[model samples]
Target: MRVVVLGGAGFLGSHLCGTLLAAGDEVVCIDNLSTGRRTNTTPFLGRPGFEFVHADIAAGPLCVRGAVDAVANLASPASPPDYHRMPLETLAAGSRGTEHALQLAAQHGARFLLASTSEVYGDPDVHPQPEDYWGNVNSVGPRSVYDEAKRYAEAVTMAYRRQFGDDVGIVRIFNTYGPGMRPEDGRVVTSFITQALNGDPLTIYGDGSQTRSFCYVDDLVRGLVAMLTSTETGPLNLGNPVEWTVLELARIVLEVTGSTSPLEFHPLPQDDPTRRRPDIGRARRLLGWQPEISAHEGLRRTVEWFRARPAEVAAAAPSVAGPQVEPRPGARIPSPRRSAPVLS
Candidate 1:
């Protein structure tokens, strides 16, 4: 199989590239390096089956010769901090970027899989979100840039499938944590790990009661591959059904890292969901995929990766300063401040 992974140098895409290469697929990685780092894919640069291209997905259609067997559109600002910081770019990638990938897939007669997100559920009212749920989302809220962009992305993906009868697969990935996750990505897993490593207080938002389901990266990658190969084209929910409270996750991070960090809390951000757990019944039936990695083991593995890459972790983590405020036990941690001013 000849596979093209857009945003290939990104945390998840990098791992996907390695996974495909290991599976005997010829891989072409396309990334702009805006958020992805070349270092992530450096190891595979010289592999006989691996090729890398540095280009923005929004710069028009990707230029790949010959037929492509598979196209995995994994490019987008995944984290809240990132999406909020680059709203237009995020939207463009989700819309235009997705279109480009689909066009490539159509042109080459390849199967297309999109790395969608649970954010599409939009502060879901349903306890365990199912694929059929229409979702409850605020289009004008702070998080709309990401959620709506993904919503549109999914819509366009479906349009391609319905109108063109294209082989399109959409996986609404839940919170996945693992070794390849960017340390400063500001997701809960990385934030908690970096904070614990630095002996800083673990921050939470909104009484610490909000819940989320985490899927291990390896398990997610497996699910992705399964979806790509399967005849089932889904807006399938792919994630571990095991749910954990924000406080529970923080405690696990502290225990795993052996950090004596205190708990800090703040108000939850706008549009932050109270609970998010994927109802993976469809995934189970269609792909026989269920998350096998527990939070404890996942966190341990993530911490080990962070510890192994001290320089990367240090560069990505937030700067430490200021005494802990009145501890808000379960509040959402603030989004990392944008390094460069975002031009509206």
Candidate 2:
């Protein structure tokens, strides 16, 4: 099979590309590098049956040669810090990027997959959010750039499926972290891991009571592949069901890294979800899939990854010389994990 993956150099997208390639599929990876790092594709640069294209899916039509059996639209500024910095670009990705990917799939009679997010269920009123839940998003909020973009993407995906009978699927991904995550991406896992390694305070927003469910990258990628090959047209939820509070997760990070970094408190960002967990019944029922990696095991592996790259983690760490100043909206830390061996 020939697969086209947008945002292919990103943390999750890079893993997807590697998985598809290992499964004996020809892969064409596309990324704009606005948020994605080129080094993420370094391992596959000279490998057979893999190609990387530097282009923005939202800018205009994508130019490609030959046939495509599947198109996975994973493009966009996915992290909170990223989307917050590139608001217009994020909006464009969900709108124009999604449209172009759908068109490409439709033209080639290929299966289409939209990599939506759990953010669509923003600050949910429903516990363990199911796909059927209408989200409680504030369209004008600071996080709306990503939340609403995904919501729009899902809407357009369903529209194409209903109106044109497009072979389309939408997977709402939750918090997934592993080797490829950038240390300074401002995600809870990455922040905790990097800070603990650097012997810095683990910054906990609010009283750290907010909750989230994290899936290992490998497990999440397997679920993605299952959705790509399945016949279900769904807004399926794909995430580990194990739930943990922000404080609990921080403590776990401390344990995993064996760091004595003290915990520091800060105000929670506006519109940040106080609770999040996925009811992945649809994915389990339709695709016969559930996460196999336990949180403790996953965190152990992740800490090992960061520990092996001490310089990268230190370089990515925010300056803490004197007064505490918030990082600029979109500032990014270089991720060297791209050069690391592919996770099995």
Candidate 3:
């Protein structure tokens, strides 16, 4: 099979590329390196089955010459810091970038897989969000840039399927973490792990009550492959259903890394989701997939990876980016930015 992975130079995209290559698939990886690091794809540069293209579909035309079997659209600013910094690019990736990939798949009569996010279920009113939830999101908020982009992406993907008979699938990915995640990505896992390894104070926001479900990258990539090969046109929730509070995650990180970094509390960001957990029953029934890695074990492996990269980990000083909040007149609403965004 031949696969075209947009944003293939990113943390999750790079991992996806490796997994597909290992399965003996031909891959044409495309990325502009805006937020994706070229180093992530360095190991695959010389591999015969892998080809990397330095291009951004959102910026201009995407010309891939050959038979395209599957298009996996993972080409957005996935992290909070990344999307926050590149708001326009994020929107473009979700909208124009997604359309380009869909168009490419349409052109070749190939399968299209859209990697949507749990953010579409923004600060969700529903707990353990199911695939049907429409989500409670502020379209004008700061986080809306990323949230609306994904919502739009999903909508466009479905439109393509209905109007043009494009074979496409959508997956709302939950918090995924593992090796190859840039330490400075600003998501909670990487931030906590990086801070713990550096012995810096671990920052907690919004009193650390927010909850998120973390999925291992390997588990996610496996589900992606399953969806790509199968004929299911679904917006399945592909993530670990086991949930953990931000504070609980922070404590676990400290214990795993054996760091005594004190926890620092701060104000919560606006439009932060109070809870996030996916109900991936559809994925299990449809694709025979479920996350196998426990957070502790995944973190252990991730911390070990970070440990090997002392320079990178040390350079990623944790910073809680948001406004301050004084205790609500003795109510003491001590919180910081949500246990880190639940983005990939």
- The order by descending lDDT is 2, 3, 1
lDDT of 3 by residue, 51-133 (tens): 88877777644657778899999999988878776767788888877887888888789999999999999988888899998
Model 2 accuracy (lDDT, Cα):
0.88
Error of 3 at 223 (Å): 0.7
lDDT score for candidate 1 against the true structure: 0.84
List model 2 lDDT by residue over 281-344, tens digit each: 9999999999999999999999999899888899776422221235656666532121211111
Return the clash pairs for model 3, or none: 123-273, 205-335, 205-336, 205-337, 206-335, 206-336, 207-335, 266-335
Error of 3 at 92 (Å): 1.0
Alpha-carbon TM-score of each model against the true structure:
0.91, 0.92, 0.93
Could you tell me how far off, in angstroms, the CA of residue 115 lies in candidate 3 after the best superposition? Answer: 0.4
lDDT (Cα) of model 3: 0.87
RMSD in order of candidates: 6.9, 5.9, 7.9
